[model samples]
Target chain A: MMRTPFEVPMDGLPDRVTIYEVGPRDGLQNESAIVPAGVKAEFLARLAEAGLTTIEATSFVHPKWVPQLADAEELLTRMERVPGVRYPVLVPNERGLDRALDHGVTDIAIFGSATETFARRNLNRSVDGSIEMFTPVVARALENGLDVRAYLSMCFGDPWEGPVPVEQVVRHGRRLLDLGCSQLSLGDTIGVGTPGHVTALLAAFAEAGVGPERLAVHFHDTYGQALANTLSALRAGVTVVDASTGGIGGCPFAKSATGNLATEDLVWMLSGLGVETGVDLESLVATSVWLAGELGRPSPSRVVQALAAESPGRRNVTQVPAEVPPAVEEE
Target chain B: MMRTPFEVPMDGLPDRVTIYEVGPRDGLQNESAIVPAGVKAEFLARLAEAGLTTIEATSFVHPKWVPQLADAEELLTRMERVPGVRYPVLVPNERGLDRALDHGVTDIAIFGSATETFARRNLNRSVDGSIEMFTPVVARALENGLDVRAYLSMCFGDPWEGPVPVEQVVRHGRRLLDLGCSQLSLGDTIGVGTPGHVTALLAAFAEAGVGPERLAVHFHDTYGQALANTLSALRAGVTVVDASTGGIGGCPFAKSATGNLATEDLVWMLSGLGVETGVDLESLVATSVWLAGELGRPSPSRVVQALAAESPGRRNVTQVPAEVPPAVEEE
Candidate 1:
């Protein structure tokens, strides 16, 4: 059976959207099992082959913090960069920036927190201190002619702090964008946001002189609100969305909690909405299925599971085209 | 950590919504394991305790067609109907209606199909033939002073015939509504719809003189588009949404496919949007967890799994109050 949704155009949405593929970085980071650098490189290649224009290759966080991506340098060296595709690496501090610069990386992203508790716990610094930490990193990355993207985590709610104020999130986000970052991807780190909150936050950003062009949304499916929140963001004029292939990540603290929204699921909705995403859903499902096999677990993505289960022969990674067809234009 | 989403009201939505809970009927109908009549009774009672006003109790289909719900009569006899809560039973034909009337059923639903293939396969009659068959059932129910709801399945797509036309669905829905049924529920049986399709379908219904007040939406989450579609429906002025507790009812054909949109997830979004549902999130989550224990399988709902994992002690079914506290008004 065909798995694609019927094309039906909606109003007040962008003609095209940029899906920032974060499978190799945000996805694998949560995995307890270590995937080899070769497999990581192959995964990046498959994502690019499946028509993703921007893929976060790997993060430069220390091995002690994220052992899964310890082979960041090795994976960058082994992987062949696809032409016209942007590969961004996460830089935690000056050291991570230095490593990214040394590898000739053209794009880098810095992670910040909207709440004080997450800033102290994740970065070992206060919210203001973390901004101070990123100021230098952003300035240095720009000096090297690298494009910078900033991630503001816990923008909606914190585990310790119930609900982060919309004003506080807008205030922190402006600071990150003020530090020469081209885009600020709002992160629902614990995935506790809904569509109304999403609209309010975007309105808050616009009120503070930041347009939707400079904003992105990154949501987790912990409470199954990620896709619905993404729809709200699109309706509010935001165009970039962050998703992981096969829905790979899960919060280590909350065992059953889902992490990032699955890229395939997002693609299915985008395709159905008649929005242009420049992605091939079938090839993307195949890539996720193959990766699930290497990880020895079934994918958490509904589209991946449904499509993979429908055609079990598609599970063979080798059968997937190294260079799949281009995205289908909706009527 | 609290599982309830922060209240953030959106513009242009109704102040309240009616969640038509179908866990006991549509949810259990797909289950291969036949639950005891007593357990099914307890599930209905707990749903009422969670503040769902309209709960579909069970299907009166013959045992040969649906063995899982063959104990429908016993279930209705064993369960105590809460005051002010409506328990609607599915009456397939005159025989089923007789059984429901014999047991003092004041509310009933009749299932029809929009697509010709689904109508033939599911009801063993053509689209028009099925409507003809339902004419007498709906007339009798109305004459008996029963509140009747008509379900038009395969409104979005059919597994055998893909991408059903919006006009065909609207026409069939009008016929069902014309049969003295108070409301017509559009069902996306295959879960292959997006926001744009939802908006277009509702608009078509309006053009055909059926207002949103008389329309309900029942979406499956097979492809992860249910909540997003629901968001669109709400924006298009739909006030009634169908959901199953614990997200049960996987398609019998596809093993990994999700069945209905989980009620807890919908409540989370509605609560966050400042829309009154009269459901307590904590109590609802506990109910889903308790039901999961009886089924010996984890819930497919992200909200259920997250809350259950957050508070391990909440898994004790006995701890859930037989009569929980009333709904929290949004401030």
Candidate 2:
């Protein structure tokens, strides 16, 4: 019965929201340019200052497949980690996790796909084989007293396999949960899943003994359903959401998909809903803008641009077509 | 209760989601290129093919303000009025509405801002003063048996006035409702308002005898919260939602606010949630892509990029610097 000072309803409001920034690893992995280790270090530091408590900083994958993140160890070592924040890195196998453990990383993540075709195409493994691969990885990571996150890719659908079944996502989710993954990140890898798919997938997981608290939702705004799909997951009891800065990181295999949801944009969403993420909207946008600039590009987060709107004489009217005559400047 | 093969938990689903496409008018108004009248005609035709039944075709504002949409007359005259569809054109005043009516317009939308500063800056009047201006316009349009729609801009907040009080929005919304506007399109002009604000403002409207049934939402992705805000509004019983193709259209006065919610993305959200927008994802993405070329830019709709992933050989990876590069190939 607590009413806001304005006497507005606060139905279904959450106490805290977790924002997982995937920009450093997932976002930077597929980019054509190799971000300087120092540039990425500064990027993470800026995100930390903006109040991002959990950011996926780097991946320990073979540099051959993802040359963009080749400076993972150097970047992580150089960045100043905030005291209370968690910085998890992606590990494809024991070798990758070994590299992370060597750096004394307390939080680590493992990844697996749901479909055989997707697993083979994206990860070069069979469906069952990928889980088998993670079993030992998860077990060893847990024994070291490290928190583990498992990313279950293609929970929505696969390109080779048109419609992803809810049961398949549930089975794999439970596997990750049973294997001692502290949290499960369900991804619409291709941004093809709708809210219906999200609800069904989550319900299936719940029925299979994994509830909302153990889940995080990751969506790519490929078809523009990422936020909507995230909302569906939240209504079903998810509190953890993962996004990339400036909407960075497109699935290399998913031709139509863009970046994961923009962290700046996601923070805008969480802050606007009265859901506290402990992040400053202005600072988050500023960080995104700076990152886009370091990469020599405009920030994809629309909120960042809008917040920067009054930049003295920024002149939004695009450059005059060279052929067209110019108009007099407004008085 | 209803169930679908889409795997949605039918029990938790919201019923009857509606979409409002402001693409033709709002989407085209800010484009640099003056789309040929024929292309605009084809664009509207494609939107209908994608299952959007409610479309805002053109704005009858003075040519001096928006030279891009000066071909409003030709656009409406040649537009194919699809059966069972409601085509609404924006009318700024008596003259604007007169031209709209002259082109066999059966639906006309009149707009006024909720903030005094915005009203005066955008329309040269106070909030009450602007309402007074639209009263006769609304009355005249409704008397002519045209379905009248009223847009209330800055309903959530204003650039000039930070954090618009829910009370102010309610007062202005009630005035528009009282004027017999068949529907009200509430706009978050600055992209500063979040889901919490949406809940606050919508709850405000409900208290003032306004039901969600007669409402539509228009959000800017300024902070990348448009979809999130739209989702909250939908949860509050709003069915009709406003969007633009490729997230096209930025307010000339409200510069820096992101484009309107992309129609392709909006449709993706609804269809996935099993809310039934009835839009074909492929066709919708196709239309958005076509329009992007028409505007000589990449679409702001992330889903359009994602849908292209389903096809082979082509990908949307080219870095789109804010301004078109001189050496960049056109088309």
Error of 1 at A268 (Å): 0.6
lDDT string for model 2 (B192-285, tens) is 5666678777887888888888888888765566777787887788888888877777543444345677876776666556677776767777
Q: Find the 10 residues in a row with the least total lDDT in model 1 chain B.
A: B320-329
- The CAPRI quality class of candidate 2 comes to acceptable
Highest DockQ among the candidates is held by which one? 1
Error of 1 at A207 (Å): 0.8
Candidate lDDT values, in order: 0.84, 0.71
Q: Give a tens-digit lDDT track for model 1, residues A74-117.
A: 99888989999999998888888888888989999988888887
Best-fitting candidate, scored by lDDT: 1
lDDT (Cα, tens digit) per residue for candidate 1, span B94-159? 888888999999999998888887676667779888888889998989899999999888888776
* lDDT for predicted candidate 1 compared with the true structure: 0.84
| Chain B TM-score (each prediction, in order) | 0.93, 0.88
lDDT of 2 by residue, A190-219 (tens): 667777677778888888888899999988
The DockQ-derived docking category for candidate 1 is: acceptable
Give the range of the ten consecutive residues with the poorest summed lDDT in model 1 chain A. Answer: A320-329
